[model samples]
Each structure stands twice: as structure tokens, then as C-alpha cells.
Target: MTATTRSNEPGKRSSSGRMIARVVWMSIKLLIIPVLCVAALIVGLAIGYVVLGDKPLSDVFDFNTWKHMYDLVFAEGG
Candidate 1:
């Protein structure tokens, strides 16, 4: 009696290959949260402009917005 081994089959992955794939997948997952937060901030800023109903669309990306945010967060109360 002889045993025959088959190398080609479904659901088969080498240990190193699987580890590399897992690392790549995890890295992508970790990056998604920060990316989504930034996207949400941009969306919120745009929405704020619409809600205010006065600012121009370009203001959302302007430096003044960042400066104002910084001041608002770190300003000393008189």
C-alpha cells in the first residue's frame, strides 16, 4: 500500500504567508479608524458651513478654520 500526497487543495496557506496576510489586514484595519475620523471631520465642517448658511465652501479648507479651532481649544479665559 502506498500513500499519495496532494499539494493542491482549497483552504491551504503557508504559515509565513498567512502571517504576512494577517499583518497586512490588521494594518489596514488599524488605519481605517483615523481615516474615517478625518473624513468625518471634513464632512462635519462642510455641514457646519451649510448650517451657518453664510460661509463660502472654500472656508472649510481654509487656515482660519484651523486657527480658530486652535484658539477655541486653547484660549485663556479673561
Candidate 2:
């Protein structure tokens, strides 16, 4: 039971090694979800706007298009 033990079993990771791997996986999972969510949102927007809404594909990535949409939803009308 030194720093790391070697098991007779094949491909068995040491306890510390497994803990490190779990921490690394948790870190990646935390970061990956938000990135994947953003990616899914962009893809959904492209499909909805261009395919279903029959708008230009380019508008999906346009800054002004988002600005205009934001304004339409939130601008002061007075």
C-alpha cells in the first residue's frame, strides 16, 4: 500500500490514479455541458430560422439580426 499499488488484475488503475481521472472527468464535464448547450442552441437557431422560418442562413450568424430581434422584444416604445 505504498503511494501506488500494482494489482494482479489487468488494466486496474491505482486508487490515486482513479481519483485523478475522476476529478479530470468532472472538470471536463462541467465545462463541456455549457459549450455543448451553446452549440446546440446555435444549431437549433439555424434550423429554425433558415429551414423552418425560411429566412437567410446568413442571418443566423448576423449581429444586426440579433440586435434587431432584441430591440423588437425589449426596446422602449415610448
RMSD to the hidden true structure, all candidates: 4.3, 4.4
- Regions more than 4 Å wrong, model 1: 1-6, 68-78
Error of 2 at 71 (Å): 1.6
Residues 50-77, model 2: lDDT tens digits: 9898999998999999999999999898
* TM-score between candidate 2 and the true structure: 0.63
Q: lDDT value for candidate 1?
A: 0.88
Score each candidate by Cα lDDT: 0.88, 0.92
lDDT of 2: 0.92
Error of 1 at 10 (Å): 4.5
Instruction: Return the top candidate by TM-score.
Output: 1
The best candidate by lDDT is: 2
